[model samples]
Target: MSAPPLNPKAGLRAALLLLLCAVALVSITAAPAAGAGPGSPDSRRGDRTVVRTEQGLVRGLSHGSYTTFDGIPYAAPPTGPLRWRAPVPATAWQGVRDATRPAERCVQMPAPGASGVTGSEDCLYLDVTVPTAEPAAGKRPVMVWMHGGAFLGGSGSDYNAGRLSVQGDAVVVTVNYRLGIFGYFGHPGLGAAPPFGLADQQAALRWVRANAVRFGGDPRSVTLFGESAGALGICAHLTSPTAAGLFQRAVLQSGSCLTSFPRGALAPGTPAYEPFAPEAEVQMVGTRAARQLGCTEGGNEEVLACLRGRSTDRLATAQLMQSFNRPAFGNGLLPEAPARALASGRFHRLPVMLGTNHDEMRMFVGLSLAAFPIRTEGDYRARLTEAFGAAAPAVEARYRAADHPSPALAWAAVLTDRSFTCTTLAAGRTIAEHAPGLSLHGYEFDDPHAPVLAGLPANPDFPYGAAHGFEMPFLFTPFPTERPLDEAQRTLSDRMVAYWTAFARTGNPNSTDAPPWPALRMSSPHAPSVQSLAPEPGGIHPVDAYATHQCSFWDRLSR
Candidate 1:
């Protein structure tokens, strides 16, 4: 999104709204529930098989088309003494470890309709899904998925990658990292320590490097892919010096280094939002959090010791956790904010694919309309004034309420272009600017009739046409859609899988089965090189997302 300048208090409010964006993922109830640790009985023990990791052997369950090894520890549990520290190697185990079920979800804010905070602190685990029928030739490509939850929620095991693995003929690994306070908390005592959640992702990538070959996957041919908060994490990794060689390609869905929201984008008076904060700011918040928890009157060690000793229930409160959702820069894992890093040409030079839904902001606006009404042009104008101040008239001229079916829809369109769509395309241009030879491509998932995720609160008059996260079910299985996709949507899913896996295999999504996906021309002002993906005939062609979304207007406004 185009960045809007902000004041301090609005900055805080914007950050909180940033975390609330994860509510989109939280409302989707289709992901699998996480199970217990080693003690959980392996119900498929009779017919299950084993795969060897560098640390030990793990048993996986077979589901005819694919095999899944769930809940394999990637690093030592970041509990007790290890809290706030960088991840260490998971202790080697004896004999075959049960991997039939998912481990406890990382500590996180409770989802809607849930009771007290739900998950365990010992949550540094990963899952592997491999097609039963391996590639006809050598090792298959490996894809590691990072789930989105605003870094306050989501488990790696939640996604059922069986469809992705089987259809693409690739090995897919999903990861679970520390969330909210437990993951992003920073402190002066922890001098230059990286975000544990980000470190956890690297640890998982290291684990993949060590054992992908054993699972019949090419260790060097790995693709890192994710959505929302997960994509932001990947954004950090792209600029993180330590992340070199972890993967060969990347896919950023619905997020980018520059992705941000303008003032009043989520609700009236809320400031502009970005997914990252500087290290000093994060430490300041952590210090305030410690004092609020009554860990005052102590030195660094004493304060941290007291804070760590506090119960998970106390720290996992919605306020404290949500406050620390933005990952910190100026540390080893992230020496600078990703937005700055990308602009200055300081990111990994690998093939990358990034995009957003055509109606990205509709999901957020639709969910909040009940709370913040925009029933007419006057209300839309008021929102513009609240968000843009002197520039409200310019924004209104470009995004008139009458151009859409309703004022609320018009507001949603404004947020989408200025925030998700343009920011993503701009990030694409930055990547190309830095690495002109890099294999780069982009897309817009514009399935206007894309199925709504289960539990989303959408008004009947306001259809969430191709809104945020609606494209997930096309690639990941068990992504509980409110209803099943019809034949055309199913066919579109097949096309997406082909393009994605083809990209993973060779850093190119182009294939014989689908329309050619043109590369984003780095120097073009319009940059009309992104593919448009939908189920309709001729929907999979290239479109000028930058020009189409009125990015030039937002760019001028941001300046």
Candidate 2:
């Protein structure tokens, strides 16, 4: 089940593919009158049309003969006094809300390369894509997508569900939830709330449960799928009782429930898990943020009001200082660490599919390359030793410098395995042990032609490989048209859509025409079995991915 890299020549093509991946999360920012009219028909899709939803009637454009809906409010805007509170139901509209124009993205820090889009407090919105002419039939499976941006970045709007809806014939929903401090910060005044970002997501799912049937979806068969932070969110839902029954199946890409980057390991010598932050520590941070805003004790609603009045930029910037580690304890919704809950077999059992990219760390490492240059083997070994200590020597021995063309590539491989591959394997084993009856599928996306974003080195010789978030382009349309998918890659995209949508349709992802996907029985030492996805026609392979990556070491550390 090893996830090896493709030829470096393929990395150039992959760098060009980044634009399409960015398109997956692109959001249209024009706002209309409250309850605006129908949207203009998109010229690309044939036959313009409008559809009625529980919120209101929206007009959307047809692309490839599929209907699209944008800026649908699944929950009320978390503005004014409701900034950090749980999401409330969207107020009923007086007239048809134009679902055509996408709303401003949820208030968050500016993304890399994003321009002119000011963040706002009124950012709780969702977009929907459906493949049906009639909503009443409601036969299409519902797939909810969560974008991955380290829990600090990413938006539901970034992902375009068009291809998944049009080609795979499914109903796709993408949402924007609060991020950073605005979404996750918790304080004592809030009365034991944990990560409000996670709560906002649950609220979105609740909105879907209440109104999905109206939009050509089967609420009973809803499947939750997320990448990175979104995957972590799915893991939250799996454990939170409040999120139970909201989704029947889950697809976690490149992140897992056990994927916690410890803030401070309790005592200096304690094991990583032992240093897990408690509800008090999270509350302490929140209380401090509140105090900084001059919020006094008492007047709960008043304090919330004052905090809400603060500028969105200030809140986003302040939240970033903590460096995106906001999910914490105290909230009744998430009473315990997700990893702890999953380990004890206390989570809500459901069919699950989880995997990571081939070179997951390259997304981060490559971007930092210009700032943090790796000039020699000495530099590489120093970073490795700092991260893994005595174990660093063993890890370096396995992934030797000779194995890669450069020290940068070698370093990227180590981080990718530790942060992504190993953590995901731990999560899979926890699920398999806790819920043996549920269907579990594991995959490693190794497409080297995977997209890389702007600002990174574009040199064809610099190999980014199948880095993190590279799989996005194959699933969504690219923003910049420079690196559109070749025919073979498009076929790979089709297969991914088939696997994801098929999983949403039923517990299993197998179809008569699609490639056969084996259920995950065990990982690593148990067996050599994993699904491999690639752009080449015969590039797909199923082997022992966990064993190839030395996931056993991770499993031991996690234990």
Candidate 3:
């Protein structure tokens, strides 16, 4: 077979140049974030409070009893020649730094338009929320959260650490990293490289290791938790040597290492798998961008220099599309697929909590209606074949509309199984097989009152229906007040806080008041398996969610 494009220069240049410039404007639009004073009697535990970090003294506020410090630089901004290189430690700062407001988001393909927050290359920053009582014990468990946006878009600032900080009573840190081509494109000139996004995460973890003590946190007790792309990132860290010892626990919600959608890896029925764009392709994009700005040929270095000198906007478009900005292979930090690493038993050994929401793909399908429209059973079968091929017929037989309440329900079930449930279960089982001693726990979030985003259709009874990312608001602080949960949801949210906090405090999430959550047993002979979190008169219990989805067939296909 012909080699994968040695140079993805054309696609990279076309994709990156448009996004860089378009987001530049948004970066400039954000009002500078302000800092809150520490030890001030006014400090409410749940509000923001800027405390001194090893890097420098800073101010923040208290939300309830949790203190939040936002936009603390963990790495020197990747700019100029530093672009595409692994992150460097941030320079030490003098006196107190104002960390009351969030910093600029990392440069990324925007949310389908030029209207959202603009970003920049200088965006390796993190926010931390710690419990006020942390100092009494001299240390609290730390939970580092990675946000999810398909490896392209998301912000640490978008998440509220109130629940984890005040309720879980842990120090919660959220980070912003480079995204799209700006984060992952590789070139020969770049030399031996690390995945920039992973590098950014490591840098933040390093920062936590060096500085968590100052915030009354035990660095060694860090738990890395993330959803979606963030969860995938946690999986990458599980196998990255450079990330060893930085965290002791991990929580992956609704994303799996084995579920990567490889682009042009190999043709169906082909024996070989390769990347679509290799080193040469990446350099070509850089070269073209240089030429577009009137740089000389053979001036690869000069071209990159010129491109960097241009405004971020000149390179990125207004819509901030992401057709060509997915993860690249061969970076040292990632080296290969996460699934392969786990299968090889090369992953970090630690307590792991992995799970998925009930309906993961509804958000994707509903948002991208034109791409995943389902008008009939025939159409559904065709889509299933495209997703599962030889296994499609078997998958259909198990998830037929006759079994589902309706066609829409059937499609939702199929998407949920293929995209999330099966994938998460596979990850848990793999971890169990490869890392025997490590405790492995799994869960399913089944909240029917989850919030709907602006772009999605409003469902009076079941718009989001335990959909992907629906459980977030219940676990974190509610933003955009319009979407606040009702009394019933509030009660459920409180229960989630109890369960998650209990999990972070102890290896297990079991508590007298909290509902029972059983540990996943790969060799179990019982019917009840995988803990299910639902708001009901029956309360949380162990249910066979896998059986409902015909996971037996999926397991065969996966093998």
lDDT of each: 0.85, 0.68, 0.67
Cα RMSDs of all predictions?
A: 3.8, 7.6, 5.7
Comparing 1 with 2 on lDDT, the higher-scoring candidate is 1
TM-score attained by model 3: 0.84
Look at candidate 3 and tell me the lDDT of residue 24.
Answer: 30
TM-score of each: 0.94, 0.85, 0.84
Candidate 1: 10-residue stretch with minimal lDDT = 1-10
TM-score-based ranking:
1, 2, 3
Candidate 2, poorest ten consecutive residues by summed lDDT: 262-271
Tens digit of lDDT per residue, candidate 1, span 1-559?
A: 2112222355445534544544545434355523312322543453335877888889887777788898999999998989888899999999889888889889877544457878899999999988777476799999999998888888888788888898889999999999888999988888777988999999999999999998889999999999988899999999999999999999999999999876777776565678888888888888788888999876999999999899999998767777777888898889999999999999999999999999998887887776678998999899889878899999899998888999999998998998899889889888988899999999999999998888677688899999988888998866888888899999899999889999999999998867899887869858668999989888888898888899999888888
- Scanning candidate 3 in windows of ten residues, the lowest lDDT window is 262-271
In model 2, state the lDDT of residue 349: 79
**Model 2 misplaced regions, further than 4 Å:** 1-48, 111-117, 133-138, 260-277, 294-305, 318-325, 459-461, 479-482, 523-526, 556-559
Per-residue CA lDDT of model 2 for 167-271, tens digit only, reads 667789888887666776666667776566787788888878877876668889889999877887888888887888989999999888866432111111112
